[model samples]
Target: MIRGVGSYLPEKVLTNAELAKLVDTSDEWIQQRVGIKERHIAAEGEFTSDLAVAAARKAMAAAGVTADDIDLIIVATTTPDYTFPSAATLVQMKLGMHHGMAFDLQAVCSGFVYAVATADSYLKNGLAKRALVIGAETFSRLLDWTDRGTCVLFGDGAGAVVMDMANDEELAAGRGLLSSALRSDGHHWEKLYVDGGPSTTGKTGFVRMQGAEVFRHAVGKITDVVYSALEQANYTVADLDWFVPHQANKRIIDGAGAKLGLPPEKVVTTVDLHANTSAASVPLALSVAVADGRIKPGDLVMIEAMGGGFTWGASLIRW
Candidate 1:
């Protein structure tokens, strides 16, 4: 069962107007193209793990579970404090958890859904009793500030959730994760990717994307995965109570929701507020909906995301 959710955005805000000063684009152009008004940027010394730990602490409190209760920790991100030690271990240490297994998963923006599915499998198989799944990113560090196309489209943030083994009664009640579908196509990786990596250049790289190509493929890919998940859960579009998609772009979100025939109000969007926080987007939107009392217990929620590497996935959850 998904026990609790939480999120954290850094204090600094970068407005589209401010971005115009750095690039040739204006606020009007950015808003028309990406629908982002502003985004949050992490402080100089604040790393991905710092944001992850802050979000994790809130999740633990909401779930009423202590650090000792978590037997597994999985953090999903492309940006790690170091390439050696997984970001999950860093979060584990900060949370004072020492007895559990911890690791990191990198699926770019589709990371949180991937992590959730992996964590669910471990819990179902009794590999762990409780798991902490976090989607955290310092994407601002990966942006080319001079390239307005990418820089204005990303931000930094973290979001997390606590999933515990549900009892038989809870399963009978349909009160946890229902089904998930994941897909990837490496051929289209160049459509969106980082320019450098440890193996390639031994340096953290900036974000690179073919915006038109990505936009062309996003709706179709997202709809396929979402429908696959819905089918696995024995559900249809009418059965969906909410659609929390990755906050990548307003155009993509609207396009996918429209293709699925979901009403505007049923879609949970934070792209305008946070831009694309990469892996952090979906969980951050989920946190907002939950905290606002829009997503209640017994509600059926659907989540989907597509990121660099052409990775895309969807998961069905019964809150």
Candidate 2:
């Protein structure tokens, strides 16, 4: 099964108390509501590629594979070291990989799910034997520190999963990724987005979002996509061994779990510790769960996420 996972966070940790000095929010307000105590921030010299490479190395080590064992490398992120050369390519270089296809995928916070789905496809199609899928973000580069609402909700980190090819018949009979359901609506694009871009402002921009509006969509969309993936896999909510949703907000996670009739114990949450690493949230959460033995082999797992660009998706894996 495609289940080699790894994750990495920066060395620096920022506590809510530390954040209070920069914003008007109180540690009590943040912790009581969002369940976030601290988040890791990238050092000045660190980039998304750096975090990605660290995670990739760990995954490869855990899987007993090397860079040459990978036939594909997909790095998902909204914040890249540069607009070109792609953070994926940079990661490939750092891994000393030269033969694999490498590229980046952008779907904001849902990027990890998207990357996972894409990697699954490559393996299922026999186009790749092994693939490294990474979600890395240096969100500190995109924050409006003056805005307390969004500023306190993000951090920097990376997580990765290494997947290998398997026959579809074998997958259907219990092998790897069984099914994936994804969707996006451009109509809600402005609800959460950056103010600048290469073609637009010719500059990198800060994140701006309506927290309340995003909160409304997140609960509904995440729950729906999870069900959608289950349906595609011919399974039900009760079949899930674990619900590793995007670690965005505690309220959203709790609400979605309640709506799905899932007990709090089934939900794997790290938002309290990592805040919202955006694209890196789900994989980071997945890695944490896997590392802690919360998610075991042969488990039926479902992953879902929603983010800027209004992008979101879900995947069902037979781990």
Candidate 3:
């Protein structure tokens, strides 16, 4: 069974009022359109690995496991501390975990679902016993503060889950992940992307995006992916107990829910509170919903995300 989830947010809070000083946008404009009021920002000394370690410790504690129990670690993010070492390896070292396969997965906002699905496959195939799946991002490192379009649309945070293997027979009796679906289209990569990179400019660059274009594809693709996940699970839209989607934009979340025949009340939204944490958004939303008791074990949960790589996907889990 995938046992527990936990999250960590940085100490510094970036309010819309403060953002106004950096860009031409107003607090009212941000709230009315994107629903973001404030977001967490990593301190100068903090890095993505720090957030991942904190979240991973919490998840391990909640699951009643230790670092020794984890056989695999998957860190998902678009923001890494460096280009050489994988973020997951950094996290493994921080956790003092020495005996496991560790790597990173980059699927932009859908990274958590991708990591989770990969962990599920590991457990289901008996290749690993316990897996640590983390979605950590320090998006402040990627933004162009001068650009109002993308600057106000992101935050920094991390979320994690600990999954343990379960026998098929036991799973059939309700002890394992039920279903998951993931998809991506590289053709839409330019819709949103960084302006420079290591090979291109010999230095990291800021993010650039077509906000309206992304907004158009986001709602439709999110709804379609959610429906596909449900269909694959042999379930219908009505069967979902909670729709935990990427905390990108308020309009996208609401629009996708409505398009999926789901009521606003059935969706879990944290965009107003957290903005888009890239790969961290979905798990962060899931962590919040579970903490609020809006989601629980034995309930049907659907997670979906759309992001910069123009990558998008969804996962259905019978908790």
Candidate 4:
């Protein structure tokens, strides 16, 4: 079961008007195309690990658990502070924890959903009792400031969830994660990816994407995985209480919601406020809905995302 959830965005707010100053795009064009009005950028020295630790602390507090109570940590991120030590290790150190195993998972925007499934498996298999799953990204560092295509579409933020083994009673009550569906096609990797990487360029790279191509495939791929997850969980669209997809674009969110026959009010959207935080998007949106009392316990929630590598997945949760 997921015991708690939390998130953190940097103090800095980069508005569409501010982005217009850096690139050739304007506020009107941005909002009309992607529905992003502003995004949060990390401070000069703030790293992905910093964002992850802060969010993790809040999730821990909300779960009413401490470092000693958590036996596993999984951080899903594309941007690590360094290439050697994983960001998970860095986060664990900051939390003053030294007893548990920690690692990182990279599936781009689909990372959080992937991490959730992984954590759930470990706990179910008796490898762990409690786990912290975090999706943190300093994506601003990877944006090409001069390119309007990708620069205006990404931001920095983090969100986390605390999960532990669920009791038979809770399972019988239909609580906790029910099912998941994950898929990927590497052939479409070039459509949305960074231009460089440590192994390829000996330096960090900038974000590069074919926006139209991504838009073309987003809705269909997203809905397929979502439907598959719902089927695996023995639920249908009518049983859903909330649809929280990736916060990449409002158009994609709307398309998926409509295709799934979910009402607008049941979809949680934060793209206008936070832009796309990559791996952090779903969890960030989930955090917002929960904080605002839009998502309550016992609700049937569906979360999904599709990102670079053409990776897509969905998870069904009985909150």
Candidate 5:
């Protein structure tokens, strides 16, 4: 069961108007295309681990648990503080946790859902009793500031959830994760990816994307995975109380929602405020909905994301 959730955005704010000064783009164009108003950028020296720690602390507190209670830590990110040690370990250290397994999962924006599935498996198999699942990103560091196309679409933030093993009775009562569907197609990797990597260029690369191609694929893929997950849970679109999708673009979100026949009020979006936080988008939106009382116990929720690497996934949860 998911015990608690939390999210953190950096203090720095980058508005589209401000971005226009750096590249040949304006607020109007960005809004019309991506539906982003402003995004948060990490300050100098701020790392993905730092954001993860802040969000993790709040999640732990909300769950009424402590660092010692966590038996597993999983961080999903495309931007880690280093190529080694993993951001998960750094987050564990910062939280003063020393036990349990800790690692990182990289599936771009679909990372959080992937991590959730992995953690859910561990808990179900009794490998872990409690787990910390976090999606943290410093994507601003990977953007080509001069390329308004990608730079204006990303931001820095983190979001986390505290989950623990739930009994069969709890599952039957719809109190935990129900099902998940994950898919990846490397053939479409070039459609959206980084220009460089440690193994490829020995340097952290800039974000590169074929925006039109991505949009063309996103709606269909997202809709398919969402329905797959719902079917696994023996539920349908009418059963969903909320649809919290990756805050990548308003157009994609709206398109996917329309395809699923979900009403506008059923969708939860935060892209206008935080833009796209990559792996952090899903949990960040989940945290916001829960905090605002839009999500409540026993409510059925669907979470999904599609990002670089052509990775995409969806999960069904009964809050």
Candidate 6:
């Protein structure tokens, strides 16, 4: 069960109008194309770990627990501060924890969903008593500012949740993660990916995407997992109280929702304010909806995401 959720966006905001000066684009063009109006950007010294720690603190507070209560930490991120220490370790240290295990999971935008599924497994197996799962990204550093297609589509932010074992009463009431379905097709990985890595160019390369190709695949892949997870939990589109999909593009999100037969009112959208935060998208939207009181206890919430590596997944949770 998820005890609490929280999210944090950087203070600096980059509006579409401001981006016009940097590239041959305008507010209307960006909105009409990607449905993004503004995005948060991290300052010069604000790293991904910093964003993760901040979000973690909020989630911990909301859960009414401290570092001593968490025995496991999992950060799902692509823009880690370094290749060695892992962002999870940095967060664990900042939270003053020395008795727990922490690590990172990379599934790009599908990260948070993957992290949640992973944490659920650990808890169910009794390997961990409580887990802090986070999805954080500094994608602004991965974009080619010159490429209007990618640069204006990402922002910096982090979102987290505190999950623990549910009591027998809560379990009987179905108040926890019900089921999840995850998938990846390496053949389509090139459609949306960064060109560099430690084993390759020795540099963090810019985001390179085949927009049309990705759009063609996104809807189908998204719906596949959505339906799979829903069915596994004995649920249907009508059973969901909230449908929170990845905040990559409005078109993809809409396409998936429509395919799932979900109404516009039931879907949560925050891309216009935060753009695409990759791994942070799902949990970010979850936090927003929770903070706004849109998602309440006993609500059937389904979260889904499709990311680079052509990775995609969905989780049906009972709130």
Q: Each prediction's TM-score against the native? A: 0.99, 0.97, 0.97, 0.99, 0.99, 0.99
Clashes of each: 0, 1, 1, 1, 0, 0
What is the Cα-based TM-score of model 3?
0.97
> Total clashes, candidate 4?
1
Tell me the deviation in Å of residue 134 in model 1: 0.3
Q: After superposition, how far is residue 282 of candidate 5 from its true place, in Å?
A: 0.5
lDDT of each: 0.94, 0.91, 0.88, 0.94, 0.95, 0.95
| lDDT tens per residue, model 5, 222-301 | 99999999999899999999999999999999999999999999999999999999999999999999999999988999
- Residue 140, candidate 2: how far off, in angstroms? 0.9
Give the Cα error of residue 25 in candidate 2, in Å: 0.9
Backbone clashes in model 2, listed as residue pairs: 298-319
Q: What is the lDDT of residue 105 in candidate 5?
A: 99
Give lDDT tens digits, candidate 2, residues 10-97: 9999999999999999899998778899999999899999999999888888888989899899999999999998999999888887
RMSD of model 3, in Å?
Answer: 1.2
lDDT for 65 in candidate 6 is 96
Runs in model 6 deviating more than 4 A are none
Q: What is the alpha-carbon lDDT for the whole of candidate 6?
A: 0.95
lDDT of 4 at 238: 99
Give the lowest summed-lDDT range of ten residues in model 1: 165-174
Model 4 Cα lDDT, one tens digit per residue, 183-250: 99999999999888878998798988999999999999999999999999889999999999999999
Query: Once superposed on the true structure, which residue ranges of model 2 sit more than 4 Å away at CA?
Result: 167-173
Of candidate 4, the 10-residue stretch with the lowest lDDT total is 165-174
On a 0 to 1 TM-score scale, where does candidate 2 land against the true structure?
0.97
Report the Cα lDDT for residue 254, model 4.
Answer: 94
